[model samples]
Target chain A: MKNNIISSIRLTIVMLILFSGAYTLIVWASSQLTTSHGNGDVIYFKGKKFYSNLGQKFTNDRYFNSRPSAVEYNAASSAGSNKGPSNPAYLASVQARIDTFIAHNPKIKKSEIPSDLVTASGSGLDPHISVTSALIQINRISKVRGISENALTTLISKQTEKPMAGLFGPERIHVLKLNIELDKMQ
Target chain B: MNTEIIGVILSFLVVVILAKPMGRYMGKIFSDEKTNLDFLFDPLDKLIYKLGNIDFKKEMNWKQHIVVMLTINLVWFVLAMLVLTNMGNLALNPDGNPSMSLDLALNTAISFIANTNLQHYSGETGISYLGQLVLMLFQFISAGCGIAMAVIVVNAMKEKVAHTLGNFYYLFVRSCTRILLPFSILVAILLVLNGSPMTFEGKDTITTLQDESVQVSRGPAAAFIAIKHLGTNGGGFFGANSSHPLENPNYFTNTLEIITQMLIPLAFIFAIGYMLKRKNLAWMIFGVMTVGFLLLALPTIWNEMNGNPLIEKMGINQHGNMEGKEVRFGAAASAYWSIATTVISTGSVNAMHDSFMPLSGLFQMLGMMVNAFYGGCGVGFLNFYIYIILTVFISGLMVGRTPEFLGKKIEAKEMQIAMGVTLLHPLLILTGTAFASYAYTQNPIELSAWLNNPSFHGFSEMLYEFTSSSANNGSGFEGLGDNTPFWNIASGIVMLLARFIPIIGPVAIAGSLASKKYIPESAGTLKTDTITFGLMIFIVIVIVAALSFFPALSLGPIAEYLSM
Candidate 1:
């Protein structure tokens, strides 16, 4: 009985500590909303200490996203490419981007290609891929995560974005969403 | 382009044909197979009941019923929160699909429960198929329940009704199976045919034009896409969102999505009129809703097509007004779709809403804040009924008679229910948005350089997104790069309030509406059949929504519009 009492006391103390800690976090969080929002600086890359800026953060290892960035998509310079898809120049520019991605991710072949990787999405700041686009990158991310390539490829079938109605559109995968999963250690 | 328009028109016509048969089917099922519709859907109903473990023999008093309903939803919220927080360890595949943090978990739980699918995390990257299914599936059911209840309330009001307003369990099943299921399935298949890959294969390895290693993303996208649009759940898997081909593959698909997104809410009003034996009254309601949608859509498309001056300066092609939208759909469809989706509470977008010009953004926001025509399915009839009652009261007061709706008296008790139903949305939006905006500003350390706009336009876009998301209208302003703790939680709360308060309010109203003595239809009743009353109802909704959101509007999008 005495031992049981002691364990209960310990449990209560731990609960108190946890509850207090959570309360403090919410309070601190509420306090943070006072000034401004969406100034991209808030995002922290998983396990990376430094915050990544929208511009000038290109790396060879990471799959590049953000279509036709304008002034690095700075809010102060918020605007679009203003180039319609049919614009030959825009097509040429996007084609150049496709070539660049191919140059970086060498294993990906031209024949087994996802258009989203080569063509700039309309948002230009797209953070997703059509399931096909993500599928195109499955082999590379599988290697990175040290998982079997075949197994990871199977996961894509599970992850693709479905059309709004069975008859309306195509399935897609948010690139950021899919990549985050690809980067998972387990 | 014209062909696409015609295709969209045909798709809409098809949806219109489907709506009432579906609505009647919905009504019949609520009567629990005593009616023909329920009998048709009995097998599916039993399947859902068996899976959900509903006990029809168990009769619940109103209080216990509310308690169970509220408790179950809150518990689902807690479970959703747990799934999100542990998504890294529990659901994350490899390397690091961005895990749902405590904040995101909270946000997602609230968003789903509230029927607001405002995602703080990008799809594909932020969530797994498991997470989306577990969290967003609830949204599908919650939305169906809210809509089913609206139809149930209308049926309960029929003086000649033989049954208690339909069972919630049966309604949920029938709505999901008969109405939501077919549409979602049809749409998903269409999306797959349009080139959205429906696969379990992880990102594929393929050599690019220049050989480089890349991780391709993949999944069963067709399953969720259709419902996301039809159910008015606007959560997107990718950050580029609905505009991405996977979410919205082509122009034909986009037009179909746009029409279907608005079809149910518009048709529900007619279902309501039929249930009340007032076909002309339904037409009057349609006139107001149609006019409202056009007013919002016209200005938004106009501004978007005019093209942004800053982009024009770069000497880019402005032929079809290129901005943040898919090329296949072009600017016109994207803009038009944005208006319809946001206006009707189906917030699937093919363009970056924040990137829209000032007046355009305003109209869209106004559609959400005031212009919820019938709103979500079950919720719409409840909201409109409040306005209908309010109209009866004020007009009756002026003419010196007790206000009667379908022969029922509008007393303080009924007024209170309507008033609560009406005020609930604005209050939640105002309070949650204000709290969120204030909290977001305090955390300067989190803001990235690209997101650090000094103007209210920037601030207002963020504010508008919070309001919209929390209110469960998934349309967002493209200007705000929302992927942070402040937004994740704040928007989460907004989604919660947007979804539940309206539901709770209407459920309370429906319960009350059900219990009231049925007043038979009389010859001397005030004519709700006229456009005047319909406009009056629309105007009151506008006034209440506008008054609530005005101060916040001034601080956010309005200031941005002015600067532009």
Candidate 2:
């Protein structure tokens, strides 16, 4: 048993050097060849750098809203609220978000607000909103930005990201990208 | 014909086609036989033995094996704690993350060592690059330890009346080099190519289209993620886990991650068949596990796809409950991944499990509670073997025959250990939940702070935390503020006891049976490989799990589902 323990200690040292040092070094070297070079994908929008990979918040009337964030869109601390549906605190927060949304958009009924608009996303940094969520916000955005509803609808359709290969995930629109395009529109 | 259905079918097909070859390869690697990749790893393997001063030929009894396993694990725990506690001073802290509190460090150390990778703290801001690497190391070795234990059990079953099983150090090293290392590298490269970050860098500041700046964290995430899934160590590089676009990248990478995590656990089932020369027994075990998995998975998929009925009633065009799920993996894929992750003890998530429908949460909890549906590496089989023993004893008594398995007599000593190991899971989980519940009820202001959801689901959160820990399945409902001292210390203890006891129990039984005199097969001997025995074993698993956990489930997801 003593011999076994000694051997175990020795073996661990070898594995640590191999896994933590050598193996990690090799992977890091390979990452240098990728597009982000291990930093992250950066987008230059109107002279400002934006991480295209991350979810950005938009709460203005003239723009489509991103999903709610538990961490307030902090990429360095990405997380969910971890709130279960049955938690009274969580339910209350959801109710409040729903109420706020209803007050802002009188044309949309209380029931028409999608859960995605009220609930915090898993990453708290979800970049996309449901097609219905985007459409629901269209009336407000069109009226506020003085754009035609038909033109905004065309822009939304253009911004929609279909589920990969047409059937794996869900159809949705990227809010940050959509908003950037929305700003580009006259 | 739908893409989601195609995705599921293709994934299953790949696993099926690969299982036999992977099983055969693993068997050869562990059996002291010459294999194709052996030329690449043999010299390094010998060198490791030499450096460790290990006598490669020396075999160990079960007690010695367990001791060595525990000792090495202890070394790792201490090493991990040191690294995590002092990570602020360590190199590779581009984000300047501080040292973890001692309690969180202890919990993190135990969680990784037990192969349960349960994160009381989030990965991005909570840990530095060096800490992540340390945890990644634990992922590999802990997973290797599980496979090593399984190998010992297989050795015990194969050798009749043997005094020693096999060299623990040899099997441990070989498991890492021959199986885990090669596969992890391949997957790592695939992940890197698919855009997972793999560099030692700090968080980058990015301005949004709104002209507001945000900090984006990056690291050598691809390498960690590859083995995280491959080794069934589901510790995420980001707090969001695979749900993060950077970590999962695209549909192809998502498919690859799911397939890799499920592969080894599935292949281990087949490896048992090939190694023991009991193909039928392997198939029977596989059938039972797949049926249980499907039973859990189908309902979860239906619940998510049906969307939240309440949301539907809101006069909203329900797009099938995309609340906390990635649009890239939708409802079906997220539900599928949840079942896959929980059953295999690979707790990596593509969606927030806490956000899953009430019934979906019930299935996830059930998966961990059973803990034998193609479980982690070799431990899954170890857990299932307990049920097999119980089933054999019960069925043997019913048939008026003496109980035996693999030509060895089943005695009281063996039965005692098996029963003890079997019941320990629920005891730890239930007892922990009960205590937490009592504490919450007594001091709602203090303890209720840990719960995110109040009422029935809140109780489920506490229950799920314990269940995840005790089963060595790390996926949690996530709403629980488990980083506190109470939860950290409590779940740490549970994870340690749950992991080691089941492993030790199975090995001890196998060791005891190996030393007993082998009896020749006779007409009176009961066959374990038959469909009837498989069905009996399945029933045994279900009955045991259901009886122990059904009340808890009813209070949690069941009530939530009905209320909704």
TM-score of 2: 0.96
Query: What value does the TM-score of chain B take for model 1?
Result: 0.89
Tens digits of lDDT, candidate 2, B1-564 = 556656766666787788888988888877777898877898988888888788878879999899888899888888988998999898889888889999999999999999999998878878999899889998899999999999999888873689799988889888888888889989998898877788787887877776678888889898899999989989899999998878887678888998899888888888888888888988999999999999998888878877776555545556566657766666778888999999999998988888788888999999999999999988998998889889999999999989999898999999999999989999998999999999989998867678778778888899999999998889888878888999999999999999999999999999999999999889999998898998999899989999999998898888987787
After superposition, which runs of candidate 2 have C-alpha atoms over 4 Å from their true positions?
A95-99, A102-114
| lDDT of candidate 1 at residue B77, scale 0 to 100 | 68
* Best of the candidates, TM-score: 2
Candidate 1 lDDT over residue span B1-564, tens digit each: 343344444545676677666555554445444554455556755654554556544543334334545655655666577667776666535435656777767877777666667766666577765565565466566667667556556665666523355455545556666677656656665565554544434444322212333334445555566667777776665555566655555556666677667666876776666566677877887777777777777677666667654434333334334445554554556667777777667676787665566566777788777635656666655666667778888878877776876666667887786687677767767776666566656765655432434456556566667558745777666446666676776666657656665556655655665566766656667777787778777777677777877887777667755654
Minimal lDDT window, size 10, model 2 chain B: B310-319
Question: How does model 2 fare in lDDT?
Answer: 0.85
Enumerate the candidates' DockQ scores in order: 0.05, 0.55
lDDT for B181 (candidate 2): 89
CAPRI-style quality class for the chain A–B interface of candidate 1? incorrect
Model 2 per-residue lDDT tens digits across residues A33-90:
7777866666776788776767888887777988788888888887777766555566
